[model samples]
Target: MTEDHLDIKTPEYVAIQFQIAGLGSRAAAFIIDQALLMIINILAIVILFFVMDGMETSPFFLTESTFPIAVVVIGLFVLNWGYFFFFEFFSGGRTLGKRMVGIRVIQENGHSITLLSSFIRNLVRLIDSLPTAYFLGIIMIFFHPKHKRLGDLVAGTIVVHERKAKKKKKLTPIEKEINLRGLTENDLELDDWTLKSFTAKDWKLVSTYASRFHQLPVEERNQLTKQIADLLLTKKGIEVAGKTDTDLENTLLVLYLVLKDEWEFEL
Candidate 1:
């Protein structure tokens, strides 16, 4: 895709927007669920209180009077925590809220979230919801472009909207050769770089500058051409010592041929 045709929004920002929407949807769902749970708990407590009131046991005994209430409250708390944790942690990176909002969480590098990730993320909710609310986490998400909560930042995870249509480009023979012989996507898996490095926008910039080379002075055009070639060589994991302008042009030509799916070009 050409640069003009591509959306240049940073992935992190995009992720933030998706997360915000998802969070809103989730908050609404949580309120409803909690409301229902609260009513049930209230009714249970009332019933237990009345049933105990009619018993012959003394009302002054702390064990019988307070213990049952404590147990019920603790049980309810545990049940709520377990339900939220299990769903968010194990069910494809989304909770009931996330699923309703059409977004899912994944590792920063687009991998599936692990059990550890889920646990840490949910566990941190305690911190995120500190001092009464999740004010800390909300502050982080609001200020940061990636909308990452404290747990997400620590876990190196991101929440993104699920894209239904991912673009796929066919590789040319020369491109194939470089990928097959030099570095496949799996081979150059560097820690800092992401698929975004070779975004469609970068490709468009290179293509435009390359095609308009003749409009500039020969030396300048040659210099630009060399840069393009170096990019291609680096992308392919090819090493060329003391490469000349002509050599770079040759590499770029090969890249162009590959992008065009014309495998018959000479080096």
Candidate 2:
């Protein structure tokens, strides 16, 4: 791990690294959150004003009561404070703004943000936002090696870029076959109506096909794939005019995913 990155090992013994978010991205996410909160507050105030004005109660009730205004002020304060805690805890460290910016908070150990960690971080946000507009937080992030603010340091948490599982791993053979011709599950999916027509015998035949798919001689695979594809698909009005070996294999695999739930089959 370096100053700009955080590294941790999982229980599975796999090491992972996360790019630490710096001032610019964090500021962008904060601005989005503040804008959302401002909109909510303005709408709430407007709605309350209208409700009070339209009430059947006497004008004196509206004019005399400071209680309603106090309640609104306190409620907004709680809303602001709880917003980060609620989202970070329940949404696994991502708020709406964080998700939009493709960054999220996580424990220093690369675990999901725990309830206590979320609460501690959000509690210290008061200090981070002090003296107006997060000035102190900005300074800390600029100087800190890991780009950590007071809240992050106190809570032992860090913000990082989102991880993409499929992009990080080498392509598996099944995945390669599916992607070979840009074919999606939609292209191979059978409707419930058609799926219901399949009987035990059809499953047995498909099981045999799946079991022998990898063992076939490369020269004979396409020919055998065409024959099986014709028997299963063409009879059901599926157009297999120009599908290649990969396309046919992908179609069979998609079927196996569903049928294997109820029937045992070896791949």
Candidate 3:
């Protein structure tokens, strides 16, 4: 099952690898969530019906003034949309179903889920729900390398098992193949904040990029390298002059592996 894991380095430089949740587990969680929401909505509608009946005989104007309609619409919205948003945000990425299933949503970088990211992902649920019963979503999850649905892809989030991550003591072959021995302290401009700024998720991306660099077309490779380098440079506030995009990208990834322990103070 080591093959199914995604590696994420902890603040201590320990490799903490998480198992990506598969379609079965994810579907179970989704079904649980839907059932709970359906129950809640049923109760809400029952209450609303009684309230509307009471108002129909009175002149309070609630039943006839579009207020009841508005309430029903908002209730549906909350049940269908806000439920995921609120739970994921407050629970640090787990809704009740996800928590029950022992899985959680996390930034692809392994960071805790944020409100905005949660909102974006939940918003894309509309697209994922297209053509009934999430057929498109199931197809996407089945075919996508990472098992991400449309919402996950749009929000740059992934669902992972909540189990303790498997740690690796030694570097993988890909890590060894791309070395930073030539890059000196001056080149990395090592700082505590620099190391802290990069997360396990970011490390995963770096590893993927480096490992697949040669396989990608030149244009795509260059574009990805530049994007990765720019994000790191902007976040860490460091600059490496006199290097091409490929060189800069490789240097950043290598520096991360080499100097990961140096950032403990900042963390």
Q: Which predicted model would earn the best lDDT?
A: 2
TM-score of 1: 0.46
TM-score of each: 0.46, 0.61, 0.58
Quantify all predictions' global Cα lDDT against the true fold.
0.61, 0.81, 0.78
Error of 3 at 253 (Å): 47
Cα lDDT tens digits, model 2, 114-214, are 99989999999999988988899999998899898999999999999888666677865554654665655555567788877766676777767767766
In model 3, pairs of residues that clash are 109-201
lDDT of 1 by residue, 202-222 (tens): 456555664674567979878
Residue 23 CA displacement from its true place in model 1, Å: 5.2
lDDT (tens digit, per residue) of candidate 3 on 200-249: 66766665775786688988977887787777665676665566976776
Q: Rate residue 76 of model 1 by lDDT.
A: 76
Off by over 4 Å in 3: 1-3, 10-12, 60-65, 165-267
TM-score of 3: 0.58
